[model samples]
Target: MVARKSAFSSEYSWFKGNLHSHSTRSDGKLDPPQVVELYRSNGWDFIAFTEHEFYSYWQELSSDDFLVLPGIEMGLDIPKFGRCHHLLGIHKSGNGAKHLVKAPPAEKDGMAGAQEEIYRLGKEGYLTIYCHPLWSRVEWEDISELRGFTAIEIYNHSSEMENHSGLHLDHWDSFLRRGIKVWGVATDDSHHWMEDYCGGWIMVNAPQLTVADLTEALVAGRFYSSTGPTITDFGLDGDEVYIECSPAKAIHIVTYEPWGRSFYAEPGKSISSAVHRVRGNEIFVRAEVVDSNGKTAWTNPIFLDKKA
Candidate 1:
């Protein structure tokens, strides 16, 4: 018998997905068919239709064969002179029962408003992850306050273009230093069905290929992030955190601690890296793999829950 590909093999351990996208229901230029075709053709296991204010209105799919997630992007702005734009809501599992709770507005217009909406989503039994927290005017309190954020994107592929500058890693370093326990997701955040738009993605480890399974894993932080590379695994012990990577060149193990700072363990070229001296009462650790071709991958934080 020919050597058959093992779906559960470590080499093919993750399910590739896009967490943010738009469709004809919102301002995105592509219809469902074209958008679905683009992602499916690119080998993505799943893609969410997070339109500006409404779910993709998925009734558009001629067949439910594709792993399409129903999600809505709730955009709210900060107070006077505060340009911070926030996104609330969830990439609802289209296969599940309807989620009827609408997030309430924290304020008429401001971060407070966005907060209320997120809380509402939570009340309705959905976990909301803050999208592009540093996008344009989006700002927040210290990394320590990140306690409730379901998760935040350390890197958003679509918004990475910082004006005329290059790659925008944003304030991800700050969150790490604070020992914030959150998953880092890399999403295409695509709107136009363009190839360059799907530059970001997350590799999720799920028992099976399905929206429900993937969504549950993501909410549990059982995944990693990347623009192009891929992370194998990450974990933390007493005062040390360990990680494993793929096609690994140089590995970076980053830990975020209290007193608002971060530390790094760069082990030149090893598939595994560990941080020995953890700081303060808490330490959130993650790992990165820089592929030989310059591409890179990231694993979600393996949190060290030390309460003081």
Candidate 2:
């Protein structure tokens, strides 16, 4: 059987969205309505209002064309490092209607606290996304054993702009290399609403653009993350793993360490597709496309040992 977890399909439409953001409900520069207007007017299909420790369902801001997902970000302290763990909890259409009633009390037990909060969020019917490991100063060792996160932020636009610690592919590969089946995401943890609002986003393939459809797609890894590049298709058929993207400077088929391959375009030119013949022994496979400007798009890994 072919093992592939591809989000692309002719039947589904792609929607651009940012899963993490803030507003004046927390410390964001814009109010909730302004944040909604900012993304809506900018061509985004959806935005999640993940204000810190404050949960609100901005259903009033949503229209037939734009969606506002109910979301909140919980912070747990790592007293040892004086930093905090940021977990984004996003609810489906009807979920998380109540305010901050079910959120767990802030804990300071380092890794254990983070794990507990993740478990709590899942139990509360929210999909948890571990946010910005590099900005949190979390090492692979700190989160290798943590479980129940639907995805981790491989790139956070705000973290990259403010702290220069946005990309966390090393942490993502650590989870995948160990056979952990978590997905990766790129988000603009946008608080400032200026340059941070549109730096990173995801393209989700879903049947429709409702909160339920988008939430389900995100939970099933039916999406890919991007800073600028676009991944048109990615999947595996038998031993042939393939990916098609926009004109790119380089395309990489990422697999188990020491086993993957990279294809680069010739000087003054660009390539748009690449294929890798799987050895039938690699743990998993994913794709990355890099544009001439060094912007990248990433696909979620497909575990070869599992059937499609």
Candidate 3:
């Protein structure tokens, strides 16, 4: 029998949510209440208001069907590089969540200062996510040494629409190639709801829609990032890994060593499922699905070396 390692489980339900967003509390166009209503009315199960260096529970916005997660976005400028580091601090609960409202004090330390802030946030019960790298002008060397990130934004809709700085698959691959196990996230990072809302999100497989359950599912990598497509199932059985998703133009099985396979649908056609037989030596495997319209979904890598 082949070792089994899957990012999702059969026992959980899928809930859609965005982990990063803004409102009038920060530099966003809408107010907190409007942002909450916009997402809740559009079928989102939860959302985090990551105001710049501001923390709020937004308890009134939450309902039995919707959740408001405590969160903040913190940044530090690199001394001379014209670059910066922005991190999302999403708390499981309000406890200790306000600790990150204050910016990091050591600005002169550059990336070191940012890493320190990330570490500190983790200690305070916040799941830290490295924000848009391309938009921030972040190179691999700038953040290669930082640790404790639950995920990195592989696709930022706002960044992509404003410029083309979103979709940092290379940055994500760099970390995975280095044996780092951080997950990939797709977010709207929406400030202006006009064209920025709902372009990207994560479908989390959690036992419930509560903050605690969502946070636990995130920490366990029970989710897939997407711009449009939906991944219904993903897992490895024996030497083969399989994916079941919405109609797609192609499916690529990516591994750490470029030893994986890609399957493409014929012209004007689409595929809804595919499978790849993994080489026994692969250290990890992940899937990327591209729809005919160019929308994509990403599955978290299954670390073969760390199989349970």
The window of 10 residues in a row where model 3 has the poorest summed lDDT is 99-108
Report the lDDT tens digits of candidate 1 across residue range 24-45. Answer: 6666788878888988888777
Once fitted onto the true fold, the runs of candidate 1 whose alpha carbons sit more than 4 angstroms away are 1-13, 57-65, 80-82, 91-107, 142-147, 161-180, 193-195, 236-240, 257-282
TM-score of each predicted structure versus truth: 0.77, 0.94, 0.95
Q: Please write out the lDDT profile of model 2 over residues 1-308, one tens digit for every residue.
A: 76764557779999999999988778889888888888888889999988777777788888989998888899887766656688998886646465544455765567888898888777777889999999998877778789988999999999999879999899988888888888999999999845788989999999998988998888888899999999989987768889989999999999985488999999999999998998887889899999999999999998875632
Which ranges of candidate 2 are over 4 A from the true structure? Answer: 1-6, 100-104
TM-score head-to-head 1 vs 2, winner? 2
TM-score of 1: 0.77
Over the full model, what C-alpha lDDT does candidate 3 score relative to the true structure? 0.87
> RMSD in angstroms, all models?
6.6, 2.1, 2.0
Clashes of each: 8, 0, 0
